[model samples]
Each structure stands twice: as structure tokens, then as C-alpha cells.
Target chain A: MDEVLLRAVVPTVIGVLVRRGAPFAAAEDAVQDALVEAVRTWSAHPPRDPQGWLVTVAWRRYLDAVRAEDSRRRREERVEAEPAPAPAGHRDDTLQLYFLCAHPSLTPASAVALTLRAVGGLSTRQIARAYLVPEATMAQRISRAKRTVAGVRFDQPGDVRTVLRVLYLVFNEGYSGDVDLAAEAIRLARQLAARVDDPEAAGLLALMLLHHARRAARTRPDRVLVPLAEQDRGRWDTAQIAEGVGILQAALARDRLGEYQAQAAIAALHADARTVEETDWVQVVEWYDELVRLTDSPVARLNRAVALGEADGPRAGLAALAQLDPALPRHAAVAAHLHERDGDLATAARLYAEAARAASTVPERDHLTRQAARLHAALRA
Target chain B: MAKYLLLKHYRGAPAPVNDVPMDRWTPDEIDAHMRYMRDFAARLEASGEYVDGQALAPEGTFVRYDGEGRPPVTDGPFPETKDLIAGWMVIDVDSYDRAVELAGELSAAPGAGGAPIHEWLELRPVLAEQRTATE
Candidate 1:
């Protein structure tokens, strides 16, 4: 049995049950149980229509659960009528699941977990391992999120932006587990993009694809970070970049500009360059200006400064950087880069050392430390 | 998520509020402290914050390589002036603030007279091996 195909139907089956009056939490649990059974029995007796089979098995499981739990007796009465196991319609309620899982009431962390479980079709254990949290802790977080949205109507329109943010969090967060969360986030984003008419959903999918295209070039064999400018351009997946840029262009043509689109535009520009010197820094700076105006985020402004340095000169970048708070993360690193470009070895070395001290991840700290050491050695020579 | 090491010093840290030596404490008080510690670990595990906790033996030795031909250089089970850690707990939490909150809770483990120890625990972040995609 194809596991991906099996997992893909999970949200659809759950959506069917929820629409039929089962609680979201119970429906989700039942679908998980049905999925386990499918793994066990599908080889012997493969279902002709996978989604239909899943809906039937999952619905039965839901009824059994409702019967077993004393508190669900009233809900059990409501769903007692068993409709014939006809093939589930192509009507996609998975979109509703996306909105429910990313409900605004849930904390950002909780929202991410719920989205991974409910829409991404990942198990609690998988999510816990991905997040480096205990299974019990992750389970509680997911259940709490489910409870928070338990009362929400299945058809109530969800905030598309909230769903996109949750998906983005899943994509960007680091995880060293069996599951590739970046891939999972892309899968969910793709599904959302298809179901929703919003251009931002497409934009988010485009952004994820663009970033994912460079996964191989992002690190060294021993897992050291390779900064974008230094990464081997040949290592990028051209096919993925083509797809991302294509989608981005379509979304941009709609003229519904969003931060994700702006970010993807920057990523596409980087991908377009074969060498560091060939990068269209002028266009990158323009995109950053759009991003800064759209979000007014300090980090965006900080990044725009780096592009400005490349487009104009190191002095111009430093002048722009000087306006921002020095305490912002990576501020020292950016300052070091611009100073080094300005031919100020001493200042660059000092800032590199400071950046290394402030680095959060081991690889980044090592990379910055090496940069500092290299500058220091050159000064000595 | 971030991992933090909560270090409990045996001798180096400034005295806690309930500063009486463990040996000087009544047997019941000792039991209470131990019980409190056990419960704390259990609670953290249930909440999914706990990674590991361990108590270290007070006696330790220092060793270093002498040369390619020699066995090694050895030093004393260091004196009281030398900082010795009593124990350590590793926790994976969501934020620095949460780590601080948990460390504060751990410091409140019962001590002599069954009062909060209020010990100073050194909290240090464990450098993450994986870099986030956005970074």
C-alpha cells in the first residue's frame, strides 16, 4: 500500500465525519485508527475507492468511540443513523480543517502542532520528535488545540492568512526527525493553494518551493551552514525553482501582493543568479522595500540594508543599518559583512566575533567564529 | 524549542535561603526534599519538558594526557574551593522565559525545615545542531 496515498485521505475522511456531526477531536482520532487498520489490512483486501473506504472505516470507528465514551452518549445519539458507505464526494472540506486547525484562539506553537497533525496527517509521535518535545507534551498541546476549536462550525469561513502563517512556521522551523517537515508543509500548502482562491496561498506555496529548491546547497557534508552567497549554485534544484517562479509569476500577475510573494520574489532573484556577483541586488532591494512597506518589520528593513549594500555600496548599507536597533538578531553579522566590504578588517573582525558570541545554532557560531579568525589572522599577517 | 542545562553546584554557588547542610537536616526533611525532587521530575515528564536529570557523585578526579608515550596526568579530587556540581537536569522548552520559570520551580525543591531551597541553579542554553530554514 502506498503510505502517502493512505495518509492523504485522512483529512478528507475526518472532514466527512465532522460534517456528519462528530466532534473534530473524535473524528480525528477515528481517522487515525482507520489509517492504522488500512496499513494492516489493505494488502489483503485493497479498497477500490480509497477515500470512500477510509470514510466508511473511519465513520464506524467514530461510532465505536462515541459508544465507548460515556460522556459522548448525547453526541452518539445525534450520529446514530448510519448512512450507506457511498464513495465520498469530490467536495473538499479539507479546507475547513485547515481553518479549524489554525484557529486564532490557539497559540502559535499549538496552531503549528494542530496543523501538522490535523491537516499534514502526521502522528503525535512524529510531531513530538520533529519538535524535540516529549510525546506527552505534544499530545497535550494538540488535544488542547482541538478542544479550543471543538465548538467551531465546520463551514465557518477561516482566516486564510492564519492558515498560511501556521504552514510557514512548519516550513521554517528546524527539525531533525524522521519526517521532513519542510516537505510536509509544502504538501499542505499545495493542498491549501488548490482549495482556496486566495493568491496569498499560492504565494506561500511559491515561497516554500523556492526555499526548498536550495535544501541541498544549504549545508556542508558535516552539517555546517553555507551562507547563500557562498553556496554552490549548481546544487540547487532547477526544476523546483522553475515551478516556484512560475507559480510566483501567476500570483504576481493577479496583483494581490503579500509578504510571502515579496519574499519569494527575493528568493527567485537569488536563484536566478549563477554567481554571487551576478545577483540582481537592485531588484532584491526593490522587493525588500515592498516587504518593509507591507509588513513594516525590522527584520525586513535589516535585510533590505544588506541588499542596499550590494546594490549601492557598503557605506550606504551601513548608513541604513545604523538607523535600526543594534540589539536586533543578526545585526552584528550584517554590520560585519558591510564593514568587511568597506575594507575595514578590524571592525569586521570585532563584529564577527560578537556575532559568533550571539549565534544561536552551533553551525552558525562555528561559521562566524571562522570568519572572525580568518580576519584576525589576515590582520596579523 | 531550546534545550537548557540546569546546573546545581555542590559547593560553588552562594548559599540558598534554606542553607542548612543536607547531612545536618533531619531524616524526614531529607525525605521531603527527595520526594519533592522526584515529583518535580515526574511533573516535567508529564508536561513533556523533561529530557534528563542526574545526581553526580561528590568525589571526582581530574586527568589529562601527559604525552604519546606516557599514561596520563592525574589531579586531586578537588578541594572545597574548586567548584563541584551536585547534579544537573536537561530540559527542552519553548523559550528562555519558560526555561527560567522551570529553573525557578526546580530551585524551590524542599530543603531543611521543609522550606524552599531557593538554590542558585546555573541555566545555560544547549547550542542547537540544526539551523532553521529562514535563518
Candidate 2:
């Protein structure tokens, strides 16, 4: 049936449950149980009003458990607190679900798991497989997270920063199993951007969109690494690139420039070019300068060096790189590229081999090894 | 936390400080070494760090498609291809240091004279499903 629509409305149903004076943890559990049953039976007999159906089922599920434990008086109190079933199209109720999932009391891992479960409407099995964790471990983490935020008010104020961070974590983890976590993250971020006027939320959405655009060209069919300089620009998702840039431009116009906005600006510069040679490296390097100023992260500084090389010269890039620690991941590979461009093939080859030894991933190591082999073959020729 | 592969080569890697080939080692030493490796992997499993451990036969042939309708061309397993990988242990740990610690323990499996092998185990990080470098 309509799975996406069901997930989108799940938060609203959960909000209704929480608003009914159900414990946050119990309400969430009941909503998930209802969702599972909906998936199994909906194909046989789809409901005319999915949201209303979900609400009735989940609310009843919540009541059934609480009824077994409570006396008539306490049951009446909860029943009195239950809000009348209204149109589930209200965005604020869903927004509160996002906040509750990203509650500050939970660890980032727990927050990400909870957000995917509660806001993204993902089952524990799907979430566990997506993250490569055991199902039992994921279950414990989600239950623990639910318990941690059980005391949180349904309308409690939430930090947008924590919410953004949790979403970023989901986006960065990529995707596996039945859940496309990157797409899920983008969906959740889009929802977050719509509800909050926070520019950073839009900025994060833009960043995810822009980065996701180039995903196809990032690897070969056999899974070999494709360097950015060589990626086929035609393969990029032009529609997503345009949407991301437009959103980023609007967010930048808000004048509350955030880290995500700065990052998106650099990504947009890369997306704007028709070819690698046409890329606006000067602007990218400038944005990196701003990024280094804002965050002072070593990773940003390292990337800025590569952009510096394109904008200026390889020697200039090496000079910028010299200021940073060589122990940084990918440092040797960057150095090797710069040296190769500077026409020092021997040093480049050595560094490439060294970098391969330290490479974190199989494809990266293979790529670096090929670089070294290519240089050696050139010398022999 | 990231997962790493501790790759041990049958050959091609630099010789260990002990310089004792497993074939040349005494039978008791060989048994002890094998037991040590097995126990190390089991201990890792108990600690929830071991994802997998696999040993290759070192006898696989290279094969490739010849044409649209033809059978695949199988090439010789050349003796000159000296960089032969023996096996690897995949470990999930909280830090690179922990992966290294486990790799170190694996390298210290007994050699001749019942001494540590001091072998080289290449530690490589397993990248996630997509391009993380895209930022």
C-alpha cells in the first residue's frame, strides 16, 4: 500500500498517543506495534483513513496495556486526558515527535536510533540492519532511549542543534538493509526544515541534498574509488543540485550563516561547474577559509589545502599542508596528489604506497595502490 | 566505532623478526600457534569485537570474461605473484588503538622456539556504504 504516507503520518499518531497521557515510552511502543500490524494487514484490507485507523489502533493498544495495570479511577483520568481524534495533518504534533526523539538526555547513537524509530517510523530490525548492529543491541538501545525521554513533556522545548546533529549522524551512516537511511535522513530533515524556521535545519537539508547529488559518480560499478576530479559530472542529479543550491541561497540570505550553510556553499560551488576544470576552486578555497575560521576542524583545513592546490599551485598546496599534522587521516594521499602534480613522481609514488598502507577502506587502498603502480609504470616506460 | 580488517599475508609482506616459516616450525609450535590464533579470535568474539575471521587457500586462479558468448578465460596462478594474502580477521572496536591491540595479539602467535612471530598484520578500516569523503 502507501508505506511512505504511513511513515509520514506515524509521528502524528504517536503525538496523539503521547497527548493522551500515555507514558512517552509506552505510547511509542504501542505506535510501533500498531505500525507492524498495519503493514501485515493493510494489503488485505486497506483503510479509508489511514491516520485515523492508526490512531484508533495505537490508542487502544496503549489503553489495553494500561487498563490491565490500573483501577477504574486512574483509567478514567487517562481517558479524560485523551484528546479527541482530530485531523492528523497538524505539523506541530509531528514536530514535537522529532524533538522528543532527539532529546538531549540520550546519547547521540541512542538519539539517532530513537529518531529513526519514532520519527522515521522505522522498525527496530530495519534500524539495526541499517546500522550493522545486532537486533538485540538495537532493541536495548531504543528501549533505553525511550526510557530516558519517558519523562519529557509532550510539548517540551528541544534544542535544534541536537536535532540537527542526530539527523546528520543518520545521513552520514549511509544506508543498508531495507532502509535507505540517507533518503530517510533527507526526508526527516525536510520535515524538520518545514516545521522550524531555523536556517541551520534548511542548511543541513541543503548539504545532504547537494552531497547526495554526486553519489552516483562517486564509485565505479566494481566499487573502485572515483576521485572527485574524475567523477562524471553528467551523472550528478541536476534536479537535486538545483534544489539544494536554491535552498542554500535562501538560507544564506537569512544572514545567520551556520556551519552547514558554509559546507553547503562549498558543495554548491562544486555542483555549479560543468567540468572539473570549470569548478570555481577560488570560491571553494575562500569558503574553506571561512569554514576553518568558524569550526577550526583539522579535516576542513586539510580539504582547504586541496582546494588551494587547484586555485593556486601544487607547491602552494604543499605549503598549506605543511602547517597541518601529517598524522591526519588521508594526509599522505593528499600529499601524494600534490607531489604528483608538482612532477615529483618518485616521492609521489612512495607516498601513494604509504597512504595505501594506512587507508581505512578497501577501495581507497586499491585506488592508492593503483596510483603507485601507475607512477612506477611511467618510470619504467 | 569503526571496523578494521587485520590482514595477514602468507608471503609478499616483509619477513617477521623471528624469520621462522610455519612449515619449518616444529609440530608442537605449529599447533600452539594455531591454537593461539583460534583462541584470540574466540576471545574477540566474547568481547563482541570479532565480526569475522577467514583464511584463504592461496590457490585461487584469476578469471575473466573472454567475449559475449565465450567461456571465461582462466589464467595461471603465477608463482611470481609473491604478495599472497593468508587470512584476515575483521574486528569492530571503539578506536583504531583497540583494533591495533587485537592485531598485535594476533601477530604475537608463537613461531619457532615457541617465540612470538612478530608478524605484520595490515590493519585497514572498513568504509561505510557510500562516499564519506564527499562531506
Candidate 3:
């Protein structure tokens, strides 16, 4: 009945309910009800075995809901036929919940939300705030997502790729709302990596760590975006960079170079540099080539152009840029960078302005606008 | 969690047969409409659902920074843009479905003659780190 024990055991109980084939919405609701009951009752009469108590109460609540829905017969049959709970040492309940939430049947959005709710034990409002949607809308989204995967077999093995994708999505949100989604994502990824030996997952974790290591230097206090080349290297997290590099090395030794692994390799190269001039641009460009081959995305190709510019020259970068689709997001911005390097200030200024107009985020727009402003100021001076 | 911007647009609905201007509405009807929105926001705030919701001014301007000697160029709120936004609500929801539900609730807000507008709201998942994450 201890508060810490309750918090630790609640997610596991929810996972058990979910794994037992309860719908996510129903399982979540039932688990929450159990927790509330525990808070009220345990304060006066503490239980000796909190986990056992929670499981008993949560299961009863779940059954009650089924009974209320008039599906008692069907649910009872399911419950009766369900496999016996794994012996305590046979499986980690928290990991099982992670796999269930990351089930391929759920869309990426739903998986992230469900995982955050069930595993992260975040409130729907908290999740909504993190994602920046109305609470009512978020509730509906999670419910619809649950309904979408209502028929998915809970016993089926989950796709590691999908699980990694969802985890990466969590980390990629960076920081928004009241939560640090990036850090949370890393925490989940660390948990996943510890529970499962997935090289790509490790690669993703490494990539995230490498990127996050530079986060302190990636933005100004005034919210201005700082390009990687412009970042102060001293401000980066060296310890995290070291851990990420080590993970990337181990993942590379697996002899399988997935896109994430290749990206991680490139990130490792970036993090290894003590200064901008020390960056192994040639190696970085080669890694980008590998990434481009694996993903074949225009964005990858565009990014490779930046690396190419560093490895070769501005002309080569521009040549690579010419081969890319003009409609690719941030094409103008990349082009401006190449033009700036090529000493065509007027063209760079114009492209910077166009890039600013095409920017998707406020920070991107501000960064692009500053580029244009810098050029204009130089021209006037 | 990613943040999303829910944009409400006055589009794709049956044309109003009884087109009464807002100023001409009965005072009680106007009061009812305002009360509905206020109550809706209050409910959301009470539930820790409120983030930032605001009715936008119909008017907008497009500004272009010219060379220092030339000054700025300005364009007004266009009359013919059929896709003009009416308002926006920013919420931090767990998933897209939650955003849709909140949008559905917002659509139930009172409008002309105290009827729910049910206007289309475009839900856009804010793309911050598309390169790193799929969602």
C-alpha cells in the first residue's frame, strides 16, 4: 500500500489487463479506477502485497465493466481461455506493455499515445498537452486508436521495427508542452534496448543520444535555431556523445547497416569532432550515401548534398542539389547555404528569403530570415 | 508527444437560408452563444484540457520586408480567399483521435441562432522533427 509501490505496480497491472485481451480504453479506465481505490483504501488499511492487491482489484473492475456492457458471457469465455499469467521470473510485465503498446496494428500516433499513457503513466491531458491538441480531441484520438486495434491478437509477437519507430517518434518531438518528450523517448528507448537485443533500436537510441547531446547548443535562449556547424562544440554533452558513439560502434559490428544505423554512424562522426574544422566530412558524406541508398528519400539526398558540399566543394554540392527535386522541403534553404558558400550573396539573400517563406516551423523561418538579413546588412554596409 | 494546431474553417456546409447578421441576432440568442463557448472553455480548463484557444480576427496582412531604403510592403485581409481561417485551438493531446474529439466538441459550440456550427476544423500535427521521427 506504499505510494511508491502503488505507482510502480499500477503500470504492470494495466499491462496485464491489456495483455489479457482487454481493450486499451477499458484496460486504462479500469487500471485508473483501481489506482484511485487503492489511494483511498490503502491510506487507512495498507496491504502487505501491493501488486497482488492491484491485480485483484483491477481485474475485478475490468470484469465489472464487461458485465455492465452486457458482454459478460463473451468476456468470461475469453478470460477463462486466456493463458495463465507468466511466472514472475518468466517475463517482465513492463516490457510486455511496451511491446503491446507498440503493436503494429496501432498507427504510429496511437502507439505513441497508448505507450505514453499505459507505460509512461501520463494523463490523457498530459499527453494532449505534450502533443498540443485539445484534451477532448486527444481523448477521442486515443479511443479511436484503441477501437482500431480492438481485434488485434494480444499474444501475437510485435514488430520491432514498428516499436522502434514509435519510440523514435517519442524522442523526435524534442521538447514541447509540460513534458520533455525527447528525454522520455530516450528513457523508453533505453528500456526497450535493455529488454530486447535490437541493433536498429540501439542505433536509434545512439542517434537520439548523439543528437540530444548537441541540443543545448542547437538553440539560443531567445529560441533561435542554431545550425550544427555554427554550434559551440564545448556546449555539447560529451558524456552522452561518448555513450552514443559506443552504442553506434557495437551496432555497426552487427554487420547490418540499417538506415538508422547509418544515420547513427554519421551522427557519431559529427559528435567525434572537437571543432567544425575537425569534422570528418568525407566519412560523413559516405555515411549519407549509405543512408540515401537505404531510404531513397529526397530529404536524405538533400542532406547528403550538404555533406557533399563539405566533402567536395560548393560547386559539387550545387551540382548534387540540381539533381534533387525542387519541391523537396527546405530545398530553398539548402540551396541558399550552397549559394552562400559559392559567394553569390545576392542569390543567397533571395534564396534565404524564399526559404524563410517556405519554412514549416517558426524557428526555421526565423533562422532563414536571419540569413537573409545578414546578407542584406552586408550589402548595405 | 507532438503538438497540433486545430484550425476551424467556415467551409463545406449548407448555405444559410436564414442569413441573419450577428448584430441583428436577439440579445438572448447572442448571450446563449457566448455562454456556450465560455462554458465549453471552462469545462476544458477544469479538466486540464485547455491549452490555447482563440477566435482569430477575420482580417490579416501580408508583409514583405523590402530593402532598408524602400520600407515594408503590406497587403490586406483578402476578400476572395475561400479558405480563410475563422479561429484556432491549440491543444496538447495524446494522439490525433483525441484532437479530433476536442475538435468535435468545439464544433458543438454555439453559432448563429444558437445552433452548433459544426464547421470543418483542419487538424494539423505539428511537424517538428520529421527527419528523426515518423509521427
| Winner by TM-score | 1
lDDT tens digits, residue span A197-273, model 2: 99999999999999999988888888777888899999999999999999999999999988899999999999999
Best by lDDT: 1
Worst 10 residues of 1 chain A by lDDT: A79-88
What is residue A326's positional error in candidate 3, in angstroms?
1.2
Q: Which stretches of candidate 1 lie over 4 Å from their true place?
A: A71-90, B63-75, B80-82
All candidates' lDDT scores?
A: 0.87, 0.85, 0.77
Candidate 2 iRMSD, 1 decimal: 4.3
Q: In candidate 2, what are the lDDT values of residues B1-135, reduced to their tens digit?
A: 477888999888888989977789989999999899889977765454556789999887999999999999999798889889999877766677878888888889989999998998899888755445253
Q: Please report the TM-score between candidate 3 and the true structure.
A: 0.73
B1-135 per-residue lDDT for model 3 (tens digits) = 436688865533334444455688778888987787788777756544456778877678889998888979998767776776767766655566777888787767666777775655688866553222211
Better of 1 and 3 by DockQ: 1
Best first by lDDT, ranked: 1, 2, 3
Task: Provide the interface RMSD of candidate 3 in angstroms, 1 decimal place.
Answer: 6.9
lDDT of 3 by residue, A95-169 (tens): 667777887777676788888777776667878777766677667666766676767665566777888888887
Model 2 interface CAPRI class: incorrect
Superposed by TM-score, candidate 1 places the C-alpha of residue A34 at a distance from the truth, in angstroms, of 1.9
